[model samples]
Target: MLTINCPWCGPRDETEFGFGGEAHRTRPADPSALSDAEWAEFLFMRTNPKGLHRERWVHSHGCRRWFNVERHTVTNEITRVYQMGSASEAAETAPAAEQAPATAAIEKQGSRS
Candidate 1:
């Protein structure tokens, strides 16, 4: 099972979270002006990079809040977890010891205070 680090609630089981989507996606500034193909591209296109991919996740059963995770797709190791709009450079470079504790499942539902 994947151990996802929740920015607000700490490390919890992957079952407690919901995968939002690929991170850093830009929305069309003028959606109404776009053609069907443009809209489709925006909706369907996503980066499937093999390493160091960033993605959004929500702590559903714990904090019920959303955050971003910089994870390695090949190893399924989460390198960093941060808030939605914060800078991630520091977390990305920090050693594993400096990163969030990436184990220990949620003891119970709604356990976070």
Candidate 2:
């Protein structure tokens, strides 16, 4: 019953979207050069962190566009939503204090609902 705000289509029901797994995963430049174990790791290995997690989500029932969502794993609070290939990726490595603005925005949005 979460409300996900699509970067292009605004807020919509979570049911309208499809989870696209962990975000920011870089595929190998030459897949054929990888060993079996290396390829397997690339396909199956993903971080399962307990706190903030970056993920990809597609608005399947709406615009059908994909975007990134920074969510809290335990609380399911979505802290930020941005279009693919944006500069927001830099925020991933930013200090926690630098991320306060995004978190505040989410908190404000939640208060409205």
Query: Using TM-score as the measure, which candidate wins?
Result: 2
Best by lDDT: 2
The whole-model lDDT of each prediction reads 0.71, 0.74
Off by over 4 Å in 1: 86-113
The TM-score between candidate 1 and the true structure equals 0.72
Model 2 Cα lDDT, one tens digit per residue, 1-113:
88987765667899999999998888999989999999999999999899998899999998787778889999999888855663455344335424434433332112222
Clash count, one per candidate:
0, 0
**TM-score, predicted candidate 2 vs. hidden true structure:** 0.74
Q: Would you estimate the TM-scores of all the predictions?
A: 0.72, 0.74
Model 1, 13-109: lDDT tens per residue? Answer: 9999999989878899999999999999899988899998878899989978777787899999887776665335334433532444532321211
For candidate 2, the 10 contiguous residues with the lowest summed lDDT are 104-113
Model 2 steric clash pairs = none
